[model samples]
Target: MLAKSFALAALASAAFASPLVVPVSGGDTPPADQVTISGITTSGTGCPQGSVGQFLSADRETFTLIFDSYQAQIGPGTVPTDARKFCQINLNLHYPQGFQYSIMKTIFRGYASLQKGVSGTQQATYYFSGESAQCSTKSTFTGPVTKDYTVEDDLTVASTVWSPCGADLPHQYQVPDHA
Candidate 1:
């Protein structure tokens, strides 16, 4: 009886697997356009301890996305002229097509971190946007995707902020227009 129960459970789990193609409309071929995401930008500011020598470690900082891209970036694009407080980082693609790909996965992976310090704060914001076809509907995920971290002498604080800042694609399944 236990073996039979296990088989039923396995069969039920298999029924809820990810679908190959998300159905948008009832027709065989729904009106769709090819949307490609070339790249994403991760930018933010950091504040370090007051001491001149006490600096935040770039090695411990990160802004990553788990989408279909060629490479991810770590650390600031350019060294902050003022490293003590309010340092900024901007990373852009050198090549046009390096990180271009399609939007297959719904939940995109994102992460950011700042090392522990006497007193400091770090924030990473990722921006994602693009034009959508006239007949398509935009995604519910809206802008200013952000992650914030604070490092105090005693404790560390972190948070994940969501925004509608991602490649704008239409609904997976299409809907007919009303006259």
Candidate 2:
């Protein structure tokens, strides 16, 4: 729910600079597994076909998404849909056997310029296809401000949804109804 939209920034940084490392409890070492992004798909008004540009680092540890037309706006003459936007990203990650993981946190980044009394919200739903459990996080911003913002939502261990240890089905981001 973005009352006044962002123009240039993205939901995530241009790329994640760090690699994902799986560790055992007590700081013990964990086995290594080859994790890769087999494919990705996007479907939403904010990320229609061909609107998103993707890039994966050579090491495959991180990726980047650039949006050409993802935005939102409000006030007179703006349609209802213009006030809200949804961009669902479904990532197909391949993990080795016995590899299990959960989304402990989610961070959203962007810039907004909202007038007084206007409020905007950003939401993300995480779920793997064929998995019953799902997790979501949301951030709300009250206006009378104009600045860049970074919001983080952490999912506790018990509240997080873990991926199937050795499942064949692909894990994807849960898209909202609007998408």
For all candidates, what are the clash counts?
10, 0
**What digit string (tens of lDDT, one per residue) describes model 2 on residues 1-179?**
44454332365543322223343233532343376767767878777899878877776655666667666667766777876677778767666655565555555566777778777776778777877788877666677778888766666777766677667455455422221
How do the residues 1-179 of candidate 1 rate in per-residue lDDT, one tens digit apiece?
A: 11100000000111111112222333342122222222322222221222111211233111222121111122334233223222221222111111221222222122222222211212222222233321212211111222322111111112211112232322121111110
Judge candidate 2 against the unseen true structure and give its global Cα lDDT, from 0 to 1: 0.61
Q: Show where candidate 1 strays beyond 4 Å.
A: 1-36, 41-80, 84-117, 126-179
- The TM-score values for the models, in the order shown, are 0.18, 0.77
Worst 10 residues of 1 by lDDT: 3-12
Cα lDDT listed for each candidate = 0.20, 0.61
Q: In model 2, how large is the Cα lDDT of residue 71?
A: 66
Q: Any residue pairs clashing in model 1, and if so which?
A: 24-173, 24-174, 128-165, 128-166, 142-163, 142-164, 142-165, 143-163, 143-164, 143-165
Model 2 clashing residue pairs (backbone): none
